[model samples]
Target: MSNSSTGEIRIFDVNPALDRAALAEQFSRNRRIQIRDVLTDESARNLHGILARETPWGLAWHAAEDGPHNIRREDLATLSQDERVAIARKLDTAMRGTDYGFTYAQYPMLDAYLKKWSPGSPQDAVLELINDQPFLDLIREVSGIAELVKADAQATLYGPGHFLAQHDDSHVAEGWRLAYVLNLCNTDWRPEWGGYLNFYREDGDIEQGFRPRFNALNLFAVPQRHAVSYVPPFAPPERLAITGWFRDR
Candidate 1:
């Protein structure tokens, strides 16, 4: 968790002692795996703090044909209460239909960093770390995708009423080789709280589901059927994580 000479925030300290071979074998079994304690204890806590306290979250809603629209925090502040509720109603309708849709809070780390949205913020440093050699090397060794050259990231927080409908990560032209979620949730995350990452069989039965475990990294090959379960109203306030795709391009 050390910073640079100029004191730039460098909170990412991935666990250097992970068993890559075992993780690789696990991933090879089903083309997906969740590695626990992916980061050092101090690093994980520091990242959790950044997401919970420092980052300004925004709304990401994808219910229409054109979306996955991002409403920044400033823009969100401009919407009336009724307008917000209307948007929620649209999401509810979309969710009930047989189509792709998702609603959650997010901070697009790569876009923010590239556009200088929050200069010198920890979120920017996190994006840099994910694309850096150490982290990418770790992912490469475990997923056995030696061509994975870069990654894009976004900080996500799934609270009450949030969900993502089932869809295969099939944007092959985008160079997506694998999708990853670095869960930074509270250690006490309960299964009943919802927000599990669910995988499905061709017949639509759930093949597997992974809880939002703190300090765990869930990696799965792209073009697979998956979805994020809805967070019920009584669930905890935050199910936080850093999520994105590891691309070979």
Candidate 2:
């Protein structure tokens, strides 16, 4: 897609052109929808590469008992190989399922990464493109959420052994109306390799599961129970995506 650069920020012109009425109806009916080919081919491929290689990532671990904790990159670098493995084992055991606990890794926040990585990084431009008014307007049209005015975004990398447990993205204080994921993996990404996004019913049964599909945007109404499955050790590729939420101002 063609885009214009203003100062250091690039304004992307790509639009998935989803069926707004159908998408709104689906969200009203089921509270979630997944739309494929969310971006032009070249733009998606370029973003996939930039996010995979350029962003600075941080590890986050969570336990049912302890909540969430972050392992800074410097701290991780100081750990010995065995120490790191031991930590991984602990996280793995804790995050096996809802009955246990969960942990995961994420790249820097789009806003924070922009400020820290350098002036005018491409990652910042991508973030700007997605957060621009046109994109937010599209989300509003599709989801039928007139109140959604702002968005928060971050890149995520799920490598072997990372996972997230089931939890509703409900923080009334945060005004998060809908959660979104822009999957950047190739369509060839395998379901068996794990890293699937799953939504659960009240009884804890899986209502839906989505494999990572390139150029796809998945959106779900807030306060719905969902989780990301663990990335298996044998998975051939890392699961990468940009995820966040649209919020009421």
Candidate 3:
């Protein structure tokens, strides 16, 4: 597996049809499964590479989130060890406290983190790496509520003991819609590590979790119940992929 971030190209240039086909196969295998894993060794590693280098930032989060939040800490099996370490360092810097703000602006629909760590920073470069072929393909394929024309993405570099509480991504905009992601972190993740995407069933009784697997896309509707599982203070760093949604104006 190779790093998914090394290449540069137009966001819309990559062929999404192939990606859409691949997802259809996965869906056929597991219909209606709340959480699924999609990234291969190479794809996962590639995700880790991009995420590691993203700029860090202080997002806005309210004590009381209006809707639901779903987090899937993706892994990067396709990247080199050295590259993975580099991304971890950035996450360490962004996530300093046990629970820090995760949204650039306060809204039930959107929140973000980046290696650069500031608003209105350099985004085109990051977007170039983020909108990889498969990742973009999956976002385009996952069908349902319309609004999010494209996924709203940014790396959530959770540093030592850093965590994002529960929240929602509904009505981020008229385009704020579906949620999907291509995880780009290393594969050596653990349970005690505390960075799991906690999903609450509509019933609000049975809450389950989806581990952030590499290359996997978590596509779900907005206004759903969820949260970013805890990331215990890892020494160097811990990270994963974050992306989602297709919108219609």
Candidate 3 lDDT over residue span 158-204, tens digit each? 44554555556667566655555445446566777766666676666
Best by TM-score: 1
Off by over 4 Å in 2: 1-12, 72-74, 82-86, 96-100, 111-117
- Across 1-249, the per-residue lDDT of candidate 1 in tens digits comes to 343111543367778789999999999999999999998887888888999999899999998573879989999999999988888888877877776789999999989999999787888878878887888889999989999999999999999989988999898899999999999997588888899999999999999999998899999999999999999999987799999999988
Off by over 4 Å in 1: 1-10
Instruction: Estimate, for each residue in 226-249, the C-alpha lDDT of model 2 and write its tens digit.
Output: 999978888855588889988897
RMSD of 2: 3.0
Model 2 misses residue 117 by how many Å? 4.4
Compute the lDDT of residue 179 as modeled in candidate 2: 95
Q: What is the lDDT of candidate 3?
A: 0.46
Model 3, runs deviating above 4 Å:
1-44, 54-137, 144-148, 234-236
lDDT of each: 0.89, 0.75, 0.46
